[model samples]
Target: MKVLLLVAALVVVGGGIGLVLVMKSAAGPEKQATKVETGDCVQLTGAGKEADAVKAACDNPQTPYVVSVKGTVKGDCPEGFYSYSVATPLRGEGVGLCLGINAQVGLCFDDIKTKTPPPLVNCSGARLKISEVFDKASYVNSPCKEGTEEVISYTAYGATQKFKSATICFVKP
Candidate 1:
Protein backbone atom coordinates (compact mmCIF):
# COMPACT_ATOMS: atom_id res chain seq x y z
CA MET A 1 0.00 0.00 0.00
CA LYS A 2 2.82 2.42 0.83
CA VAL A 3 4.39 1.79 -2.56
CA LEU A 4 1.08 2.48 -4.28
CA LEU A 5 0.71 5.86 -2.50
CA LEU A 6 4.22 6.88 -3.48
CA VAL A 7 3.57 6.04 -7.12
CA ALA A 8 0.36 8.07 -7.19
CA ALA A 9 2.05 11.11 -5.69
CA LEU A 10 4.87 10.92 -8.19
CA VAL A 11 2.49 10.71 -11.10
CA VAL A 12 0.52 13.76 -9.94
CA VAL A 13 3.65 15.85 -9.48
CA GLY A 14 5.02 14.90 -12.84
CA GLY A 15 1.75 15.69 -14.55
CA GLY A 16 1.66 19.15 -12.97
CA ILE A 17 5.20 19.95 -14.06
CA GLY A 18 4.53 18.74 -17.58
CA LEU A 19 1.47 20.90 -17.85
CA VAL A 20 3.45 24.00 -16.84
CA LEU A 21 6.10 23.36 -19.42
CA VAL A 22 3.57 22.94 -22.17
CA MET A 23 1.87 26.21 -21.37
CA LYS A 24 5.14 28.13 -21.40
CA SER A 25 6.16 26.77 -24.77
CA ALA A 26 2.78 27.55 -26.29
CA ALA A 27 3.17 31.22 -25.42
CA GLY A 28 5.68 31.54 -28.28
CA PRO A 29 8.07 34.52 -28.43
CA GLU A 30 7.88 37.27 -25.86
CA LYS A 31 7.05 40.72 -27.16
CA GLN A 32 7.81 43.78 -25.06
CA ALA A 33 4.63 45.51 -26.18
CA THR A 34 1.79 44.63 -28.52
CA LYS A 35 2.30 45.61 -32.14
CA VAL A 36 -0.38 47.67 -33.91
CA GLU A 37 -1.46 46.77 -37.46
CA THR A 38 -3.63 48.92 -39.64
CA GLY A 39 -4.71 47.73 -43.08
CA ASP A 40 -2.12 50.06 -44.58
CA CYS A 41 0.68 49.87 -42.04
CA VAL A 42 2.30 47.98 -39.20
CA GLN A 43 3.91 49.91 -36.36
CA LEU A 44 6.17 48.38 -33.75
CA THR A 45 7.70 50.18 -30.85
CA GLY A 46 10.55 49.27 -28.45
CA ALA A 47 12.05 46.79 -30.90
CA GLY A 48 15.76 47.16 -31.70
CA LYS A 49 16.69 49.31 -34.74
CA GLU A 50 17.70 46.54 -37.12
CA ALA A 51 17.53 42.79 -37.50
CA ASP A 52 16.55 42.19 -33.92
CA ALA A 53 13.54 44.46 -34.23
CA VAL A 54 12.47 42.86 -37.47
CA LYS A 55 12.64 39.39 -36.03
CA ALA A 56 10.84 40.41 -32.90
CA ALA A 57 8.02 42.12 -34.80
CA CYS A 58 7.44 39.43 -37.37
CA ASP A 59 7.60 36.50 -34.97
CA ASN A 60 7.38 34.79 -38.38
CA PRO A 61 9.24 36.00 -41.48
CA GLN A 62 7.54 33.76 -43.99
CA THR A 63 4.30 35.75 -44.18
CA PRO A 64 4.10 38.68 -46.58
CA TYR A 65 1.91 41.64 -45.56
CA VAL A 66 0.25 44.18 -47.83
CA VAL A 67 0.78 47.78 -46.66
CA SER A 68 -1.64 50.65 -47.26
CA VAL A 69 -0.71 54.33 -47.50
CA LYS A 70 -3.00 57.16 -46.43
CA GLY A 71 -2.95 60.91 -45.59
CA THR A 72 -3.45 64.23 -47.34
CA VAL A 73 -2.02 63.86 -50.85
CA LYS A 74 -0.36 66.88 -52.43
CA GLY A 75 -1.47 68.54 -55.67
CA ASP A 76 -4.98 70.02 -56.20
CA CYS A 77 -7.60 68.11 -54.25
CA PRO A 78 -9.34 65.52 -56.44
CA GLU A 79 -12.68 66.44 -58.03
CA GLY A 80 -14.22 65.00 -54.92
CA PHE A 81 -12.67 63.41 -51.81
CA TYR A 82 -10.39 60.59 -52.89
CA SER A 83 -7.01 59.17 -51.97
CA TYR A 84 -4.21 58.38 -54.40
CA SER A 85 -0.83 56.70 -54.32
CA VAL A 86 2.35 58.68 -53.91
CA ALA A 87 5.82 57.40 -54.78
CA THR A 88 7.75 54.64 -53.04
CA PRO A 89 11.24 55.62 -51.93
CA LEU A 90 14.39 53.62 -52.42
CA ARG A 91 14.98 50.73 -50.04
CA GLY A 92 18.53 50.91 -48.72
CA GLU A 93 20.58 52.24 -45.84
CA GLY A 94 21.85 55.82 -46.26
CA VAL A 95 22.59 57.98 -43.30
CA GLY A 96 21.18 61.53 -43.42
CA LEU A 97 18.86 61.05 -46.37
CA CYS A 98 15.79 63.21 -46.97
CA LEU A 99 12.99 63.40 -44.43
CA GLY A 100 9.33 62.43 -45.14
CA ILE A 101 7.94 59.76 -47.47
CA ASN A 102 8.73 60.45 -51.13
CA ALA A 103 5.40 59.11 -52.36
CA GLN A 104 2.30 61.24 -53.08
CA VAL A 105 0.69 63.09 -50.16
CA GLY A 106 -2.97 63.19 -49.02
CA LEU A 107 -4.99 65.98 -47.48
CA CYS A 108 -7.95 65.66 -45.16
CA PHE A 109 -10.48 68.47 -45.29
CA ASP A 110 -11.62 69.63 -41.87
CA ASP A 111 -15.10 70.56 -43.06
CA ILE A 112 -16.24 68.31 -45.88
CA LYS A 113 -19.00 65.79 -46.29
CA THR A 114 -17.89 62.53 -47.86
CA LYS A 115 -18.07 58.80 -47.34
CA THR A 116 -17.10 57.84 -43.81
CA PRO A 117 -13.47 56.86 -43.58
CA PRO A 118 -12.92 53.21 -44.41
CA PRO A 119 -11.97 50.70 -41.79
CA LEU A 120 -8.23 50.76 -41.14
CA VAL A 121 -6.59 47.56 -42.29
CA ASN A 122 -4.50 45.65 -39.78
CA CYS A 123 -1.11 44.96 -41.38
CA SER A 124 0.99 44.94 -38.27
CA GLY A 125 3.04 42.03 -36.90
CA ALA A 126 4.42 40.77 -40.22
CA ARG A 127 8.02 39.57 -40.44
CA LEU A 128 10.58 41.43 -42.52
CA LYS A 129 12.57 39.01 -44.66
CA ILE A 130 16.23 39.90 -44.61
CA SER A 131 18.88 38.64 -46.98
CA GLU A 132 22.56 38.74 -46.03
CA VAL A 133 22.76 42.29 -47.35
CA PHE A 134 24.46 44.81 -45.08
CA ASP A 135 22.17 47.84 -45.44
CA LYS A 136 18.90 48.48 -47.30
CA ALA A 137 16.20 51.17 -47.28
CA SER A 138 12.80 52.30 -48.71
CA TYR A 139 11.09 55.68 -49.07
CA VAL A 140 7.44 56.93 -49.40
CA ASN A 141 6.11 60.41 -50.05
CA SER A 142 2.94 62.44 -49.43
CA PRO A 143 1.58 65.02 -51.80
CA CYS A 144 1.96 68.77 -51.13
CA LYS A 145 -0.30 71.75 -51.71
CA GLU A 146 -0.23 75.38 -50.57
CA GLY A 147 -2.74 74.80 -47.78
CA THR A 148 -2.95 71.12 -47.14
CA GLU A 149 -2.04 68.57 -44.50
CA GLU A 150 0.10 65.54 -45.21
CA VAL A 151 -0.01 62.39 -43.10
CA ILE A 152 1.44 59.14 -44.42
CA SER A 153 1.89 55.53 -43.42
CA TYR A 154 3.56 52.49 -45.03
CA THR A 155 3.19 48.84 -44.08
CA ALA A 156 6.05 46.43 -44.65
CA TYR A 157 8.13 44.04 -42.55
CA GLY A 158 11.84 44.32 -41.88
CA ALA A 159 11.56 48.07 -42.25
CA THR A 160 13.68 48.65 -39.22
CA GLN A 161 16.28 46.33 -40.64
CA LYS A 162 16.64 47.63 -44.20
CA PHE A 163 16.24 51.29 -43.30
CA LYS A 164 18.06 50.71 -40.04
CA SER A 165 14.91 52.43 -38.72
CA ALA A 166 11.45 53.43 -39.94
CA THR A 167 9.83 56.75 -39.26
CA ILE A 168 6.37 58.24 -39.97
CA CYS A 169 6.23 61.96 -40.50
CA PHE A 170 3.75 64.73 -41.32
CA VAL A 171 4.57 67.36 -43.90
CA LYS A 172 2.68 70.66 -43.58
CA PRO A 173 1.62 72.23 -46.82
Candidate 2:
Protein backbone atom coordinates (compact mmCIF):
# COMPACT_ATOMS: atom_id res chain seq x y z
CA MET A 1 0.00 0.00 0.00
CA LYS A 2 2.84 2.44 0.84
CA VAL A 3 4.54 1.73 -2.49
CA LEU A 4 1.27 2.37 -4.35
CA LEU A 5 0.79 5.72 -2.51
CA LEU A 6 4.33 6.82 -3.45
CA VAL A 7 3.72 5.97 -7.11
CA ALA A 8 0.42 7.90 -7.13
CA ALA A 9 2.06 10.96 -5.55
CA LEU A 10 4.81 10.91 -8.16
CA VAL A 11 2.26 10.72 -10.95
CA VAL A 12 0.29 13.65 -9.57
CA VAL A 13 3.40 15.80 -9.23
CA GLY A 14 4.50 15.00 -12.78
CA GLY A 15 1.05 15.85 -14.13
CA GLY A 16 1.08 19.21 -12.35
CA ILE A 17 4.45 20.11 -13.85
CA GLY A 18 3.23 19.11 -17.32
CA LEU A 19 0.15 21.28 -16.98
CA VAL A 20 2.29 24.32 -16.07
CA LEU A 21 4.47 23.88 -19.09
CA VAL A 22 1.50 23.62 -21.42
CA MET A 23 -0.08 26.80 -20.07
CA LYS A 24 3.16 28.75 -20.42
CA SER A 25 3.54 27.70 -24.02
CA ALA A 26 -0.03 28.69 -24.80
CA ALA A 27 0.46 32.19 -23.37
CA GLY A 28 2.93 33.08 -26.13
CA PRO A 29 6.04 35.26 -25.92
CA GLU A 30 5.75 38.68 -24.34
CA LYS A 31 6.15 41.62 -26.70
CA GLN A 32 8.98 44.05 -25.85
CA ALA A 33 8.71 47.78 -26.53
CA THR A 34 11.16 48.83 -29.20
CA LYS A 35 12.09 52.02 -31.04
CA VAL A 36 10.85 52.70 -34.54
CA GLU A 37 13.41 52.24 -37.28
CA THR A 38 13.71 53.38 -40.87
CA GLY A 39 11.72 51.10 -43.20
CA ASP A 40 9.73 49.97 -40.18
CA CYS A 41 5.94 49.85 -40.22
CA VAL A 42 3.83 51.81 -37.73
CA GLN A 43 0.31 52.65 -36.65
CA LEU A 44 -0.99 55.90 -35.22
CA THR A 45 -3.26 55.96 -32.20
CA GLY A 46 -5.17 59.15 -33.04
CA ALA A 47 -5.68 61.86 -35.61
CA GLY A 48 -3.67 65.13 -35.76
CA LYS A 49 0.01 65.90 -36.11
CA GLU A 50 0.96 65.06 -32.51
CA ALA A 51 -0.85 61.73 -32.31
CA ASP A 52 0.94 58.87 -30.64
CA ALA A 53 2.47 56.31 -32.97
CA VAL A 54 3.58 52.77 -32.25
CA LYS A 55 5.83 50.44 -34.18
CA ALA A 56 4.07 47.46 -35.66
CA ALA A 57 4.87 44.41 -37.68
CA CYS A 58 4.86 45.35 -41.35
CA ASP A 59 2.43 42.58 -42.10
CA ASN A 60 0.10 43.61 -39.33
CA PRO A 61 -3.27 44.42 -40.88
CA GLN A 62 -3.73 47.28 -38.45
CA THR A 63 -0.52 48.98 -39.59
CA PRO A 64 -1.24 52.00 -41.80
CA TYR A 65 2.13 53.59 -42.38
CA VAL A 66 5.24 52.30 -44.11
CA VAL A 67 8.45 54.18 -43.41
CA SER A 68 9.47 55.44 -46.82
CA VAL A 69 12.24 57.92 -46.03
CA LYS A 70 14.16 58.63 -42.87
CA GLY A 71 16.53 61.55 -42.42
CA THR A 72 16.83 65.06 -41.08
CA VAL A 73 13.83 66.63 -42.83
CA LYS A 74 14.78 70.05 -44.16
CA GLY A 75 11.87 72.46 -43.66
CA ASP A 76 8.53 70.76 -43.94
CA CYS A 77 7.64 67.78 -46.07
CA PRO A 78 6.62 69.33 -49.41
CA GLU A 79 3.42 67.28 -49.40
CA GLY A 80 2.64 68.35 -45.83
CA PHE A 81 0.96 66.04 -43.28
CA TYR A 82 -0.99 64.16 -45.91
CA SER A 83 2.21 63.78 -47.87
CA TYR A 84 4.69 60.92 -47.50
CA SER A 85 6.07 62.50 -44.33
CA VAL A 86 4.27 61.90 -41.08
CA ALA A 87 2.40 64.87 -39.60
CA THR A 88 4.77 65.00 -36.66
CA PRO A 89 8.47 64.31 -36.22
CA LEU A 90 9.65 61.12 -34.54
CA ARG A 91 11.87 60.92 -31.46
CA GLY A 92 15.65 61.18 -31.93
CA GLU A 93 17.65 63.08 -34.57
CA GLY A 94 15.75 62.49 -37.82
CA VAL A 95 12.12 62.30 -38.89
CA GLY A 96 10.54 59.42 -40.74
CA LEU A 97 8.20 59.78 -43.66
CA CYS A 98 5.58 57.07 -43.47
CA LEU A 99 3.83 56.36 -46.71
CA GLY A 100 0.26 55.33 -46.31
CA ILE A 101 -0.43 51.68 -46.95
CA ASN A 102 -3.72 49.85 -47.49
CA ALA A 103 -5.34 53.23 -48.17
CA GLN A 104 -7.14 51.67 -51.11
CA VAL A 105 -9.20 49.54 -48.77
CA GLY A 106 -12.74 50.58 -49.66
CA LEU A 107 -12.49 51.71 -53.26
CA CYS A 108 -12.70 49.33 -56.21
CA PHE A 109 -9.62 48.36 -58.19
CA ASP A 110 -10.49 50.71 -61.01
CA ASP A 111 -10.96 53.53 -58.54
CA ILE A 112 -7.60 52.80 -57.04
CA LYS A 113 -5.95 52.84 -60.43
CA THR A 114 -7.44 56.14 -61.50
CA LYS A 115 -7.20 58.27 -58.35
CA THR A 116 -4.33 58.99 -56.02
CA PRO A 117 -4.45 57.08 -52.73
CA PRO A 118 -5.67 58.95 -49.68
CA PRO A 119 -3.92 59.51 -46.34
CA LEU A 120 -4.21 57.02 -43.53
CA VAL A 121 -7.13 57.40 -41.18
CA ASN A 122 -8.05 55.95 -37.83
CA CYS A 123 -10.18 52.79 -37.80
CA SER A 124 -13.33 54.47 -36.51
CA GLY A 125 -15.63 56.16 -39.02
CA ALA A 126 -13.55 54.78 -41.82
CA ARG A 127 -15.53 53.89 -44.93
CA LEU A 128 -13.18 50.99 -45.43
CA LYS A 129 -12.57 48.71 -42.44
CA ILE A 130 -10.06 45.95 -42.10
CA SER A 131 -12.04 42.82 -41.32
CA GLU A 132 -9.19 40.40 -41.54
CA VAL A 133 -5.50 40.85 -42.27
CA PHE A 134 -3.14 38.05 -43.25
CA ASP A 135 -0.25 37.11 -45.50
CA LYS A 136 -0.68 35.82 -49.05
CA ALA A 137 -0.74 32.15 -48.00
CA SER A 138 -3.17 32.57 -45.10
CA TYR A 139 -5.53 35.18 -46.62
CA VAL A 140 -7.95 32.72 -48.19
CA ASN A 141 -8.30 30.77 -44.96
CA SER A 142 -8.78 33.83 -42.76
CA PRO A 143 -12.32 34.58 -41.57
CA CYS A 144 -14.12 37.89 -42.06
CA LYS A 145 -15.76 40.03 -39.43
CA GLU A 146 -19.50 39.75 -38.71
CA GLY A 147 -20.67 42.93 -40.45
CA THR A 148 -18.20 42.93 -43.27
CA GLU A 149 -19.96 43.89 -46.50
CA GLU A 150 -17.17 43.47 -49.00
CA VAL A 151 -13.71 41.92 -48.94
CA ILE A 152 -10.62 43.21 -50.76
CA SER A 153 -7.00 42.26 -50.82
CA TYR A 154 -3.84 44.22 -51.66
CA THR A 155 -0.32 42.99 -52.29
CA ALA A 156 2.86 45.03 -51.86
CA TYR A 157 5.52 44.20 -54.37
CA GLY A 158 9.10 44.21 -53.19
CA ALA A 159 11.96 45.83 -55.07
CA THR A 160 14.03 42.66 -55.37
CA GLN A 161 12.98 39.29 -56.71
CA LYS A 162 14.04 37.56 -53.49
CA PHE A 163 12.05 39.83 -51.19
CA LYS A 164 9.17 38.34 -49.26
CA SER A 165 5.74 39.73 -50.16
CA ALA A 166 2.78 40.60 -47.94
CA THR A 167 -0.98 40.77 -48.49
CA ILE A 168 -3.66 42.74 -46.64
CA CYS A 169 -7.42 42.26 -46.38
CA PHE A 170 -9.98 45.07 -46.14
CA VAL A 171 -13.74 45.15 -45.78
CA LYS A 172 -16.29 47.75 -46.77
CA PRO A 173 -19.30 48.39 -44.58
Candidate 3:
Protein backbone atom coordinates (compact mmCIF):
# COMPACT_ATOMS: atom_id res chain seq x y z
CA MET A 1 0.00 0.00 0.00
CA LYS A 2 2.82 2.40 0.90
CA VAL A 3 4.61 1.67 -2.35
CA LEU A 4 1.41 2.35 -4.32
CA LEU A 5 0.97 5.64 -2.47
CA LEU A 6 4.54 6.63 -3.27
CA VAL A 7 4.06 5.89 -6.97
CA ALA A 8 0.83 7.92 -7.06
CA ALA A 9 2.53 10.86 -5.36
CA LEU A 10 5.39 10.72 -7.85
CA VAL A 11 2.95 10.76 -10.72
CA VAL A 12 1.06 13.70 -9.28
CA VAL A 13 4.27 15.70 -8.70
CA GLY A 14 5.53 14.94 -12.18
CA GLY A 15 2.22 16.01 -13.70
CA GLY A 16 2.27 19.27 -11.75
CA ILE A 17 5.76 20.12 -12.95
CA GLY A 18 4.85 19.31 -16.53
CA LEU A 19 1.80 21.52 -16.37
CA VAL A 20 3.86 24.46 -15.06
CA LEU A 21 6.41 24.12 -17.84
CA VAL A 22 3.73 23.97 -20.48
CA MET A 23 2.01 27.09 -19.18
CA LYS A 24 5.29 29.00 -19.01
CA SER A 25 6.25 27.98 -22.52
CA ALA A 26 2.84 28.94 -23.81
CA ALA A 27 3.34 32.44 -22.37
CA GLY A 28 6.08 33.52 -24.69
CA PRO A 29 7.07 37.10 -25.41
CA GLU A 30 4.43 39.30 -27.03
CA LYS A 31 4.53 39.41 -30.81
CA GLN A 32 5.86 42.57 -32.45
CA ALA A 33 3.20 44.65 -34.27
CA THR A 34 3.01 45.67 -37.91
CA LYS A 35 2.39 49.32 -38.64
CA VAL A 36 -0.50 49.72 -41.14
CA GLU A 37 -0.15 52.59 -43.59
CA THR A 38 -3.63 54.11 -43.84
CA GLY A 39 -5.43 55.78 -46.75
CA ASP A 40 -4.48 54.64 -50.25
CA CYS A 41 -7.96 54.71 -51.86
CA VAL A 42 -9.26 51.31 -50.82
CA GLN A 43 -13.06 51.56 -50.98
CA LEU A 44 -16.06 49.22 -50.63
CA THR A 45 -19.27 49.84 -52.59
CA GLY A 46 -22.81 48.38 -52.64
CA ALA A 47 -24.64 46.99 -49.62
CA GLY A 48 -24.61 43.51 -48.12
CA LYS A 49 -23.26 41.34 -45.33
CA GLU A 50 -19.62 41.71 -44.41
CA ALA A 51 -18.97 38.43 -46.15
CA ASP A 52 -20.67 39.76 -49.28
CA ALA A 53 -18.37 42.73 -49.26
CA VAL A 54 -15.46 40.33 -49.16
CA LYS A 55 -16.95 38.27 -51.94
CA ALA A 56 -17.48 41.25 -54.24
CA ALA A 57 -13.90 42.33 -53.81
CA CYS A 58 -12.77 38.78 -54.49
CA ASP A 59 -14.97 38.69 -57.58
CA ASN A 60 -13.88 42.14 -58.68
CA PRO A 61 -15.03 41.49 -62.25
CA GLN A 62 -12.50 44.13 -63.20
CA THR A 63 -8.99 42.77 -62.70
CA PRO A 64 -6.84 39.80 -61.86
CA TYR A 65 -5.66 40.12 -58.30
CA VAL A 66 -5.06 38.73 -54.82
CA VAL A 67 -6.76 40.54 -51.92
CA SER A 68 -5.09 40.89 -48.55
CA VAL A 69 -7.34 42.10 -45.77
CA LYS A 70 -6.35 45.32 -44.02
CA GLY A 71 -9.32 46.27 -41.82
CA THR A 72 -13.14 46.40 -41.72
CA VAL A 73 -16.19 48.12 -40.24
CA LYS A 74 -19.16 45.87 -39.42
CA GLY A 75 -22.06 48.18 -38.66
CA ASP A 76 -22.63 49.34 -42.23
CA CYS A 77 -22.01 46.14 -44.18
CA PRO A 78 -25.26 45.82 -46.18
CA GLU A 79 -27.15 42.63 -46.93
CA GLY A 80 -27.63 42.80 -50.72
CA PHE A 81 -24.95 45.19 -51.92
CA TYR A 82 -21.18 45.45 -51.66
CA SER A 83 -20.72 47.28 -48.35
CA TYR A 84 -17.07 48.18 -48.48
CA SER A 85 -13.85 47.64 -50.43
CA VAL A 86 -10.17 48.40 -49.96
CA ALA A 87 -7.45 47.65 -52.52
CA THR A 88 -3.82 46.87 -51.84
CA PRO A 89 -0.78 46.18 -54.04
CA LEU A 90 0.36 42.92 -52.58
CA ARG A 91 0.52 39.46 -54.23
CA GLY A 92 -0.39 41.10 -57.56
CA GLU A 93 -3.41 43.11 -56.39
CA GLY A 94 -5.12 42.81 -53.00
CA VAL A 95 -8.58 43.98 -52.03
CA GLY A 96 -10.35 44.16 -48.66
CA LEU A 97 -14.00 44.43 -47.63
CA CYS A 98 -16.04 45.36 -44.56
CA LEU A 99 -19.60 45.83 -43.23
CA GLY A 100 -18.92 48.25 -40.43
CA ILE A 101 -19.62 47.98 -36.60
CA ASN A 102 -19.59 44.22 -36.13
CA ALA A 103 -17.77 43.20 -39.28
CA GLN A 104 -14.66 41.13 -38.58
CA VAL A 105 -11.18 42.00 -39.83
CA GLY A 106 -8.78 39.67 -41.66
CA LEU A 107 -6.86 39.00 -44.90
CA CYS A 108 -8.35 37.94 -48.24
CA PHE A 109 -6.58 36.68 -51.37
CA ASP A 110 -8.23 35.86 -54.68
CA ASP A 111 -7.04 34.57 -58.06
CA ILE A 112 -9.02 36.45 -60.74
CA LYS A 113 -8.98 33.84 -63.51
CA THR A 114 -10.61 31.11 -61.41
CA LYS A 115 -12.46 33.48 -59.04
CA THR A 116 -11.54 31.46 -56.00
CA PRO A 117 -12.08 32.68 -52.44
CA PRO A 118 -9.08 31.73 -50.41
CA PRO A 119 -9.28 31.44 -46.66
CA LEU A 120 -8.78 34.73 -44.86
CA VAL A 121 -5.97 34.84 -42.33
CA ASN A 122 -7.19 36.51 -39.18
CA CYS A 123 -4.29 38.43 -37.76
CA SER A 124 -3.85 38.84 -33.98
CA GLY A 125 -5.99 41.96 -33.60
CA ALA A 126 -9.12 41.28 -35.63
CA ARG A 127 -11.90 42.61 -33.48
CA LEU A 128 -14.23 45.63 -33.72
CA LYS A 129 -15.67 47.69 -30.90
CA ILE A 130 -17.91 50.73 -30.43
CA SER A 131 -14.79 52.56 -29.35
CA GLU A 132 -13.39 51.84 -32.78
CA VAL A 133 -15.83 54.24 -34.40
CA PHE A 134 -15.07 57.15 -32.11
CA ASP A 135 -11.37 56.57 -31.52
CA LYS A 136 -10.49 55.10 -34.93
CA ALA A 137 -9.30 51.51 -35.30
CA SER A 138 -7.00 50.06 -37.98
CA TYR A 139 -5.44 46.84 -39.16
CA VAL A 140 -1.66 46.67 -39.53
CA ASN A 141 -0.25 43.80 -41.62
CA SER A 142 3.02 45.01 -43.09
CA PRO A 143 5.76 42.36 -43.36
CA CYS A 144 8.76 42.78 -41.15
CA LYS A 145 12.40 42.17 -42.14
CA GLU A 146 12.49 39.41 -39.52
CA GLY A 147 9.42 37.72 -41.07
CA THR A 148 7.33 38.32 -37.94
CA GLU A 149 4.04 40.22 -38.24
CA GLU A 150 4.09 44.01 -38.10
CA VAL A 151 2.31 46.23 -35.58
CA ILE A 152 -0.66 48.26 -36.85
CA SER A 153 -2.21 51.02 -34.77
CA TYR A 154 -5.32 53.17 -35.31
CA THR A 155 -6.12 56.61 -33.96
CA ALA A 156 -9.62 58.07 -34.40
CA TYR A 157 -10.41 61.71 -33.89
CA GLY A 158 -7.06 62.42 -32.25
CA ALA A 159 -8.08 65.76 -30.80
CA THR A 160 -11.17 67.20 -32.47
CA GLN A 161 -14.17 64.95 -33.14
CA LYS A 162 -15.11 66.60 -36.43
CA PHE A 163 -14.51 63.47 -38.48
CA LYS A 164 -14.09 59.91 -37.36
CA SER A 165 -11.12 57.82 -38.50
CA ALA A 166 -11.46 55.84 -41.70
CA THR A 167 -12.04 52.12 -41.55
CA ILE A 168 -8.56 50.64 -41.04
CA CYS A 169 -9.07 47.44 -43.05
CA PHE A 170 -11.58 46.16 -45.59
CA VAL A 171 -12.54 47.58 -48.99
CA LYS A 172 -14.54 45.13 -51.10
CA PRO A 173 -13.20 41.62 -51.52
Best by TM-score: 2
lDDT of each: 0.29, 0.45, 0.31
Ranking by lDDT: 2, 3, 1
The residue ranges of model 3 lying beyond 4 angstroms of the native Cα positions read: 30-173
* TM-score of decoy 2: 0.34
Displacement of the residue 70 alpha carbon in candidate 3, Å: 13
**Candidate number that wins on TM-score, 1 or 3:** 1
Per-residue lDDT for 1-173 in model 2, tens only? 99999999999999999998787666433211124554566665544444444677765656655543344444332221223323333333334343434332432221222122244455555555544554442346445556655443333345642212334445653
* Rank by TM-score (best first): 2, 1, 3
| Model 1 lDDT tens row, 1-173 | 99999999999999999997777666434431122112222222232222111112322232222122223224332222223222222322211111112221121123222322222122242121111111122244333233323333333344442322232232222
TM-score of every prediction relative to native = 0.25, 0.34, 0.19
RMSD of each: 16.9, 16.1, 18.1
Per-candidate clash tally: 38, 0, 45
